[model samples]
Target: MSTPDQPAAFKPPANDPWKGFRGVCSGTLILESIVVFLAIPAIAKLGEGVGAGAVVYLVVLGVVMILACGVQSRPWAMGLNLGLQVALIAGWFVHPAVGAMGLLFAAVWVYMLYLRKDIQARIERGLLPGQRD
Candidate 1:
């Protein structure tokens, strides 16, 4: 059913769990930071329905994301990103106005995960200009 020239799919071990988690974490930090920068202030001024606590949460999460994104390794990023995503998702239930931002964050996180297959290759061979991985 398969040809010799075809390469097998690269799958991280199920037991490792953390690999996927780290990828999500890394993506979360990057995306969440952007959302917070744009959404929180907008909601504060435009909506006026979202409370100060929600704004405070976004600011704090932004700070944590800044620290988490500084890590160079992918696995580390994944863990942090997972925690961050969980926090954002949880926030959605507590604050629907803020929760809307998670959709954007989730979209970016999924997109980043889709490109994760090249992580090792990029670390070894280097990324070309405008390359996705």
Candidate 2:
């Protein structure tokens, strides 16, 4: 029996696939935000001659990373995350450690994107036998 307040069946969340790849990406972004912020004081201590602008840039980047993570489920968010990766790589000039972090995150980002595509393909081709279409 069905009622106006209840459907005849239940539906799972469609947007997240491949065991919550989007969730993984979102978590990675939040973690990156924290790492970026933690590097701020080190940037100041480097004393190879840094300006307030450097700190400001890192702060703004950290904030953007956190905010963007919240919207990772949106299609455009993939691009935003990639852009942040590039920025992180560019931050290498500030310190080699930032570049290393960027490389690691970039690798994870690529893996997530690849997984998403694979999952979508399986869903479309009806090959994912254990799951609903």
Candidate 3:
């Protein structure tokens, strides 16, 4: 519907940006937080010296994720999210298993971001359902 200079008659998402990406990431974070909460006791048993700190860290991370998801329109939110995912990898200090899980989620984050890009490109090309090519 559009060339290089203008919008098509089939206008697309104009008001919200990155909505799909934000939603996916936010949902993932919610589940991650739940996992962290459930794993607290196990982590506490494994990292005797760092258990309390780990608990606090996990709680704070969840809070930050909530805030980031709430304000995903801000560019910094995604950066903060990625930064936290990297930080989660540091859970290896507490337990190798948790660290391994963190790495898995980190990969998920990466895949989702790439998926988002592909989705956006499809929308732009009118390749999505209900879109005109």
- Top model number, lDDT: 2
Off by over 4 Å in 1: 1-31, 46-48, 118-133
38-113 in candidate 2: lDDT tens per residue?
8887766765755677677788989999999778767798999999999998888867877888899899889878
Q: For model 2, name the residue pairs that clash.
A: none
Candidate 3 lDDT, 1-133, residue by residue in tens? 4587885664465444466677877888888777766667766666453466777877776677666667766777767778878877887776776788789889988897788779778778756655543
Task: Give the range where candidate 3 is weakest over 10 consecutive residues by summed lDDT.
Answer: 8-17
Error of 2 at 116 (Å): 1.2
**Segments in model 2 whose C-alpha atoms lie over 4 Å from true places:** 1-19, 45-50, 127-133
**TM-score of every model versus the real structure:** 0.58, 0.74, 0.76
lDDT-based ranking:
2, 3, 1
RMSD values, in order shown? 8.4, 7.5, 3.9
28-77: candidate 1 lDDT, tens digit per residue: 57666877767666776654456777778878877788778667374466
The candidate, 1 or 3, that scores higher on TM-score is 3
